[model samples]
Target: MEKQGQRCSGLVLVPCPFQGHINPMLQLGAILHSKGFSITIAHSQFNSPNPSNHPNFTFLPIQDGQTDHDATSTDFISLITALNVNLVFPLQESLAQMIKQEEKKERITCVIYDAIMYKAEEAANHLKLQTIVLVTNSAATRLTHFTYPQLQAEGYIPPKDSMLRDLVPGLHPFRFKDLTILNFPNLEALLQLIATTIKIRTSSAIICNTVDCLEQPFLAQLKKQYQVPIFSMGPFHKIAPPSSSSLLKEDTSCITWLDKQAPKSVIYVSIGSAASIDGRELIETAWGLANSKPHFLWVIRPGSVRGLGWRELLPECFKKAVEERGCIVEWAPQKEVLAHVAVGGFWSHCGWNSILESICEGVPMICQPCFGDQRLNARYVSHVWKVGLELDNELERGEIERAIRRLMASKECEEVRQRATDLKVKVEHSIREGGSSYNSLDDLVNHILSI
Candidate 1:
């Protein structure tokens, strides 16, 4: 252990209280470890049970032994309300003091903090160490969050109740006909977002997981406005090995199965770790996948069943019909699944990590955006990236079936797949040895040393 006392580069990685954030942080941690940094990753006590987190990674559980009210779960509202430093401060302080004890031999040289965990910033400042903020989302998403006030004023956001947002300048001409964030925010939701946006901007330097090519226009604008250094060294897992994707337990079988199918012939469906669907919708989706007659793999969470009673979530008939074509699991090796030759397309929630992964894997998406900036990502995938189609937030089986068929059997799908392949090449180049991301990491390391 490269603890304090020696002159090693001791580092701490603080991810927000969520899986989406945690995923990227882990990848970066792996990279840092490969580059010789001693790493400490803090996990919320809330997520202690998850097996997906790496065992070798140092784990600091926040909110340990707390009730549900104090834990941070998948529910966005519940998490924001339940989590606080009161629940996490002890761990933070202890770790800091431990560092102090070891500073002579190998110093706790710097911090790589999550932008959401602003308290980590204070901890770094108190310790008088250089701190860099990791913004795991895309450049555009960060820019949107940062510029929410302006978007609200321009009427692009706080969108009229009838449709999708249509007014962000220099962005896709989107109209929320797809049941987007237009449900209108409750007062608390509005306030929380505003607070988060303001707090995140306070970081000393920002590290985003995106490349310059993907969102250069927006990234350039943000770089110009901020005084601190902004680096784009992302799609961080472009050629990642499938060590810890969702389907870790079953990835080998899943990929072997995919190999039996014809090339580019199957649809890989996943709605991310946190999304849940009703029984009615599940049945419809099952029927659609079956009707489309495509080889498919659908990741269904154990607790996703509706009516608060999961027994009735899947009927015997639907399951029987789709079993041969469908492979269902709580989480499957999502990255490997996407990269499979049999996986011609993807059905997803448009999560930023998922989007980047799919783009890097060269798989076209069938977007079913659920929340937050997902709608914006869906738009970019469909319009800008030219890699996928939108589910339009409609749960009907006919649309699902038709979309699958078109995605697999049409000229457009082939074109999109080809384009995705090209993008994948570019994404790989950006993260490889001496690639843009490789150099960006160097610059980041040097920046921390200078600070």
Candidate 2:
């Protein structure tokens, strides 16, 4: 590691332009900046982060050839494929200009890019610059990327409905239906993306946004497969100083509402930025929260509910039912919401970031995964970690109500709450002076400096 007061190297970070992917990469940038590295954020123009929020770092915008409509489009695979093809040359040109301008004041060290933004790695490689890959998902999810080909070879990719309940042969605890592969619509395109992402190019090290205690087995498997150093130093929101990286404006009024509620009495519901629900499911969710007998804070992101532009389409009856007990917002400051004392349970989509935040805060979850790694994450949360319950069946008001009550109020779930609390304690320890994440972070910084 660089000496405490020494000038550290300048590092450029290229984040995938999505809420989930952008948050951790920026948080990572914050962490490195605190460690004395000069930070440059080279991001795509579409859904670009507000530079004002991170004024300390230099922001470099690369033309991604995406319009506002493209950014708002729900077709994830096509968007990703287009971004990969379009960003390569512009990113390379940006990096080239940066090197020329900053060569004298602060030598550019390496480019650290989100794994999904493989083109960033390509651009940096063309410039003969060192690079590091940041895996923003769980180690378990990353492991599936390696095993997908094998699963396909065994004819399990488009799994039979009969086999859905069975556990995968090598990847234990993951059922056929729980595979990330089953969630995407275009199998060939997703598989191609995965193949390209998993290939090792010029990266000197790999960094994961996961805790070692929760994913030791998967981390061990990954270490055996890759030649570069692997670092598990995360729950990045906790490691980095607090800052707003939200693409959508967050309503802080929810925090005030949470304050008025009784301790451990609220259920926080947010399905994440990308996932969408049908009108019927949204209606069920509204009624469920209304009848669940707990104070609830729900995020109904604009355009997240199909056929409904926002939350306005909900029936007046459901609105009246929840009028007194529920608070709904377009988006919430989730970290703040999860950390609140009134948030006893989370009804989440099991996005890795949300899972880590919930674990860090000692809040039990009601796992309702939507797609991709979320399915696997929900499985682990409810089964492997034993800190949450899953909603496996289709959305129904009664089932939703029961799930919420079981997680937030039932005596039977005290054990789950206790386990969540224990994990929270462990997460706290992992960031302390002598802990796993702390040591891993030191190793990562040293590795970056060595490059």
Compared with the true structure, all predictions reach lDDT values of: 0.71, 0.90
Query: Which is the leading candidate under TM-score?
Result: 2
Clashes of each: 12, 0
Q: Candidate 1 regions off by >4 Å?
A: 1-6, 49-56, 69-75, 153-157, 162-165, 174-181, 184-188, 198-202, 239-242, 245-252, 308-311
Q: What local lDDT does model 1 show for residue 387?
A: 87
lDDT of 2 by residue, 1-451 (tens): 4565554589999999999999999999999998879899988889899999999999998889998888877777889888988999998998898778875447789999999998888888899999999999999888888988888898988788889999998888999888888857788888988999887788999999999999999999999889999999998999999999999999999999999999999999999998999988988888888888898999999878889565566888877776768898999999999999989999999999999999999999999999989999999999999999999999999999999989977786899999999999999999999999999999998888887
lDDT per residue for candidate 1 within 1-451, as digits (tens), equals 3335547676777776566877787777776766666677765666542434565456666554556755524455445534545434655675677676775545666778767666666666666666788888777766655655565667656665554444445454545432233553463475465456445444568888888778888888778767888878887675333346232245457777787888888888888866678878887888899899888988776666556554456678877887777776666777778878788889998999999989888899999887776877888889888889988757999999989988888888788889888988888887778887778878876776555
Against the true structure, candidate 2 has what lDDT?
Answer: 0.90
Prediction RMSDs, each to the true structure: 3.3, 1.6
Which residue pairs does candidate 2 place in steric collision? none
Query: Worst lDDT window (10 residues) for model 1?
Result: 239-248
Q: Positional deviation of 13 in candidate 2, in angstroms? A: 0.3
